[model samples]
Target chain A: MTPIKGLVLAAHGSRLKASNEEVTEFTQVLASSLIDQYKHIVPAFLELAKPSIEDSIDAAVAAGCTDITVVPYFLAAGRHVREDVPEIIEERQKAHPHVTIQATPHLGVSEALKQAVIHLL
Target chain B: MTPIKGLVLAAHGSRLKASNEEVTEFTQVLASSLIDQYKHIVPAFLELAKPSIEDSIDAAVAAGCTDITVVPYFLAAGRHVREDVPEIIEERQKAHPHVTIQATPHLGVSEALKQAVIHLL
Candidate 1:
């Protein structure tokens, strides 16, 4: 049987609940847009918010996702992006060796961000 | 004489100097793209970094800019975006009525952001 593919949008969570909600809401929007490609697109946080990255990965694995991608929804590479997130994902990968767990580059590094800024101008 | 136009990219500053530098570097890239329209494209921080919004506006005015736009480089409409930035800009506007100072919608609200995410996938 073909395995299910899942995605997790990992964000630098905010103290403001509303701020975190914005990330969750955007994750839903992404899910809607890529409905065919991913069975689940979950929102997780690194700190100061609920559903940490580990929990989200566990949930996805429990839901029968054999392949999962964690995309950092951050603008720049900080300590969290450079050290924390990758370390967590590496540990999780060891625990779920059968599952293909990968972390992509953060959103800020994308060329599309430059285009977005240009579009605003 | 034609009035000079300036732009300020206001970011939620980070303690990590490298992270702050990323925003500054990106502002330079934006400046390059908008060379014809804006004479100066400066980068400022809400906090935890140098060159506050007010200072950027002051510097731009000193540089002979009659019109300036402050673009919030944030991903969400949080307190910093909704309250702090506008309040700062409002006070600055009052102080510099001769200059047309305006704050544009943040980068996150742009449709280009969604397109950027799509490109990532």
Candidate 2:
């Protein structure tokens, strides 16, 4: 089997189901585009939603992904990004020390997104 | 005086000053690029921080802006985006009906952001 890599789009979940769905919907689009790079594009939330970060990471490992990158779908590196996420990743690392779990930077100070918003405005 | 158009980056405020500062940093970069389009770029919050959405909008109007666009810096169109933001905008509209107040879409389901993440990965 080909060594698979998972790309987890981590988000701060909300009580509203629609809010959680947004991350899934976004992951679908991102997965389609990133099919070549990452085999699994999972959307995980911090709280108030399903597919908790731990569960998503487990699923990624179960799916045979040797490398997993948890990309925070956050606009800034706040408490959730700085603290909560690292705690979860640390626990997961102990569980699956073999898997190379990586967490990417939050969505702050981006020229591309800034331009996109400018064009959007 | 050149008529200013304020681009308010409406975000969910955090108790942590660093979290709120992230939006300010992002806005500074965004503002530099958008200086030609918008006269001022303000950062507003829904709760738990200074510069409430109302205050930011009021500043925009006071600064001689005829048009103001309140862009939600949210990743999802959840309760805050769907209900809280609209309610605030409606009230602001009543106060300054002359100022063309517009709310742009949230940051979910974005192709540009998706591609940016993919490239970053």
lDDT of each: 0.86, 0.87
Docking class of 2: medium
Q: Per-residue lDDT for A57-108 in model 2, tens only?
A: 9999999899999988788777898999999999999999989898988877
The chain A TM-scores for the candidates, taken one by one, are 0.92, 0.94
Q: Which ten residues in a row have the lowest lDDT in candidate 1 chain A?
A: A105-114
lDDT of 1 by residue, A36-60 (tens): 9999889999998989999999899
Candidate 1, pairs of clashing residues:
none
- Give candidate 2's whole-model lDDT: 0.87
**DockQ numbers for every candidate?**
0.51, 0.68
Candidate 1 stretches with Cα past 4 Å from truth are: A1-3, B1-3
Worst 10 residues of 2 chain B by lDDT: B112-121
Candidate No. with top DockQ = 2
lDDT of 1 at A103: 85
